[model samples]
Target: MSDEDGAGAGEQLSDDQKQEIAVWFLSNAPAGEIHYVAKDVRALLRDEAVYEAAAAEAYPEYNKAHLVSLELPDRSGDIIITTYGELDKNNYLDPRTAQVATVDHVKQTCTKLRPAADEELPSAYIEEFRNAIDMELSKYVGEAYPKGVCAVYCTSGKDIEEPGADFGLAVVISAARRSPQNFCNGSWRSVWTLEFSYAFQLVEIKGKIQVDAHYFEEGNVQLDTDIDRKDSTLLQTPEDTAVSVTNIIRHQETEYFSSLEESYLNLSDATFKDLRRKLPVTRTLFPWHNTVAFTLTRDLANELGIGK
Candidate 1:
């Protein structure tokens, strides 16, 4: 049941009395948040359950303001690519447009179901898949060097401990490029080499997967010319070896609510009527993308039927 219709503190404050106080308080006072301290207020006006409902009705603008205050930011990323995964509905944004404004509500659930038994591939097929990747990458490496280097790694959400669900695949493609440098008054040509790294990520959602590919320029790295070639081996030094690195794509995880009890307050009709007679009417306009707060004084609280 809503807090408004719920039972109040004991037989001292009946539902009718609380409702009457809430209605009166709302009508009398200017539209704003009203706070009453139990110790400072009278017994009749001490309960706030009735006040909150009345305030919501009398001051809809205030409630809307409170709701908007909980909004969170949208998710963004690099070039996205998906193969088996889809992004039609299940994505970073929630399906319900109305609840989008709610802070606790998420846009999409990144839960992936297990593939059907028939859809599963054999171990040999999986190994072949890995080999196929190596073959495709080898085609891009310069013919001068056959030892083309590439790295593949996996990353997952904080909650994922094993290779179960919500896993991402990252591939770093490092290719060699050669350019000639003029030295000794343009008489000598120095061959300088660069290692271009291209990175991409595959993230699985409910029915489909989402892929984000990094820009070529952002992942490129220039390496030392290292061109003392003996046979097919381009030697820089014994200590110099190409290293493969994986770029991790970061995203916000879903936030869960905790089960805990807490006390909150609002204003009632009778209290509002009393407030109208006692407190001065204050007015303020709300903005589109901001939060506003105010403090009601003791004298105002007392006059509004808050206490003696």
Candidate 2:
């Protein structure tokens, strides 16, 4: 429900009141509430029951959020990936927070189904998903992370603990608050969960160690099959090392240069802005690029009397 739903708490809804509320909702939303009329209404009568069933009441009461049941696919057989909103139709901002965002309020039950059994399935596959939860996960509240609540969500990996319907889910919520918009623009920003800018292993099962990751952002997740390390002898000689460390070094260099260029630009811009405040400017060259040894462009060299 929205923060401004205006449902005053008169010390919890009673059995009669709950029934009346359901009747009211059903009467008001007959077209949409038709499916849930058979199920869920009894459970949702009391707020506590609703929270206990949905696992979404973890936020502070001020947020005024409600529990939402998201039905992800069982992945029975065919190659089709089952997608559902972690909470598609929230009463708040863009409740459908995913790549695919559409809702038909006509029914609450699943609209479609697929088969995943007959086709040979891998032992497991990496599923990339995301969301933002809270910092502290308490027993009284629902499942949140160890930081403040994050607005973004990414569910990157599912380990598939069992073969049947009893699969385990490793959910990651992007709980970082007060961040630059770039941080959530599908780019990596350091987060406490990712261990603060340490080297990481993206280990996808595409069959080789082809890695391309920029900044390991807060909510990014990996299936960690450790597929690359699985067949390694750990102490093999260079002759047997199909994976060379040089390739890794090259990747790091590429990422480093990109960041260096960004930093240089920022420094340059800041330096010039500050200098204009203090003295006359013959050029707009910011001095920030001077903090580290400047790497001048060929054209800039001749202008600055370097390589003259």
Candidate 3:
């Protein structure tokens, strides 16, 4: 790649393709994720330089310092949201509720790596690193994976390590499917390969906790039949769907979050019994974590007259 401002270094790539390349580079580059990140940052700064030059020529009032440079906080983290699934207009499930199952996850955390000195700007560095990535993407402007990046700028970090306090400087990812025709090509065909970026934050925790439960329209018999039939129509169900779901909850309760059982002890016998009566399927409630997840059978839901 030529070093002439690094604006036009390589062949223009689609936004998705660029992200794929970036992921591969971060995971497998010879120097590793950190090294590749630094290199990308330098390249992005070069692109910024090129932009400034062009803008300066066109508008005499253009200021280089005022350019859209990255402003990062001392303790900052990066979040990446990846979502899949076509917009099924026929389905009536709440998008937000369904999205709870497929929310994006934080692929990396840079908080611990930040410089300890008070004068250092670790967040700024991280933001610059992220900006460099955005700069590397092609200059496309349409919805089909159009190139763009956004960051939350902060000035401070969480210093106290209080118990039960979530990471002060952290990144979280959330994702949801959109309409099938959300990103149609010139031929009006939905482009499944396309992706987009979104970000948000939650400020407070109320008295209530959100729960996630997947309701199967088909009863256990139908679920088993579908699994056995291996019908392509049941795209969401695998042959081991029942087994996998059961094992997942079992594993989380028995091995991963064993402390949850202690938290369960605090609930009154009536509440506990009522919970089991309502959700008799493979389920687990982690009171300490404020999470209750369930995998329900259609028959049980019907018995409760849930969707009648």
Report the number of the highest-TM-score candidate: 2
The runs of at least 3 residues in candidate 3 whose Cα sits more than 4 Å from the true structure, single-residue gaps closed, are 1-126, 129-168, 177-211, 214-308
TM-score of 3: 0.16
Ranking by lDDT: 2, 1, 3
Error of 1 at 228 (Å): 83
Which is the better candidate, 2 or 3, if ranked by TM-score? 2
Alpha-carbon error at 93 in model 3, in Å?
29
TM-score of each: 0.17, 0.19, 0.16
Model 1, range 1-308, lDDT digits (tens) per residue?
34477754443556666766665554433112222321122245555665455544433332221111112233221111111112232222221111122111121122332222322222332223223433443333223123223322222232333332332322332221112121000000111122211121222221111111111132322111111211111212111211111101101000000000000012222223343432234453323122111112221222222112
lDDT of each: 0.24, 0.26, 0.24
lDDT of 3 by residue, 142-261 (tens): 222222222221122323222222211111111111221322001001111111111221221111111111222231111111000011111112223223322332232223122323
lDDT of candidate 2 over 1-308, digit per residue (tens)? 44377555545555555555655444322111223442465455546554333222222111121111223233221111112123333222211222232222222223443232311121322121111111121110122222212222122223433322221112122211222242211111111111101122221211121111212246532111111211111212222211322233223323543554454457445644565433356645435545332332221222212112
Candidate 2 vs 3: which has more lDDT: 2
What are the clash counts of all predictions, listed in order? 32, 23, 3
